[model samples]
Target: METSLETVALFSLKLAYEEEGLSPILRDDLVMGDYQKDVFELLVRRGDVETIQFKLNQCLGLAMDALGGAEKPLGRELRKLSADFGEVRSMEQLNQPLLALKGYLKDIL
Candidate 1:
C-alpha cells in the first residue's frame, strides 16, 4: 500500500526529532532543551495541520520519552507537554504543544 501523507509526516517529525533534536541533547550530556524546533518549524510551514495533529497524537509518546528522559528544564517542560497534550482529541488541542515546542526550540537554539 502507498504510504499516507500523514504517516510520512509523522515519520519525518519523529526522525528529525531523534536525529537533529534529541540526539544532540542526549549526546552532549545536557538536558535543558526540547530540540526539534527546526523539524517542527518546517512541518508547520510545509505540512498539513491535520497531519501534524494526527502524527503528534499518534507519536506523542516518542516525543515524551525523548523529552522526559532527563531532569532539567526541558524535562519539566516535557512533563507539562505530556499532561497538556494527553487529552487532545482535536486539532486545536495541538496548538499548545506545537507552539510550545516552537518556543522552547527558539529558546534552546
Candidate 2:
C-alpha cells in the first residue's frame, strides 16, 4: 500500500480520541494542528497493521520528544495500542474493536 502522512496522522488522532475519550481541551491541538491532515493521509495509504502501528509509535515518540521525553499518561495509552495491534497482527487474530475501526475508516472515505 502507498503510505500518505496525512492519513496516518488522522488515524492516530482518531484512535487516540476513541481509545482515551479525550476531552475537548486535550483534543484541540490534535484537531487544529497543520500537520495532522497530511500525516493521517500518509498512514491511510500505508494500510497495513504493522505499518500503521509503527507510524503511531513514531507519532507518540515525536510527542514525547517534544515534551522532553517525560512519562506522560498518553504514553501508556500509546503503548497499549502498540501492544494490542502487535498481538493481533494477522487478520485472523483481529478482534471486534479493530475490525470496527477498519470498517469505520472505510466508511469515512
Candidate 1: tens digits of C-alpha lDDT, residues 13-109: 4433646534443322222122233444555566445545555544444544555543766657655755564555554456665555545434443
Instruction: Please give the lDDT score for candidate 2.
Output: 0.46
lDDT of each: 0.45, 0.46
- Report the error of model 2 at residue 86, Å: 2.7
State the lDDT at 50 in candidate 1: 57
Q: Which whole-number lDDT from 0 to 100 does residue 44 have in model 2?
A: 52
Clashing pairs in 1: none
Shift of residue 58 alpha carbon in model 1, Å:
7.9
Best of the candidates, TM-score: 1
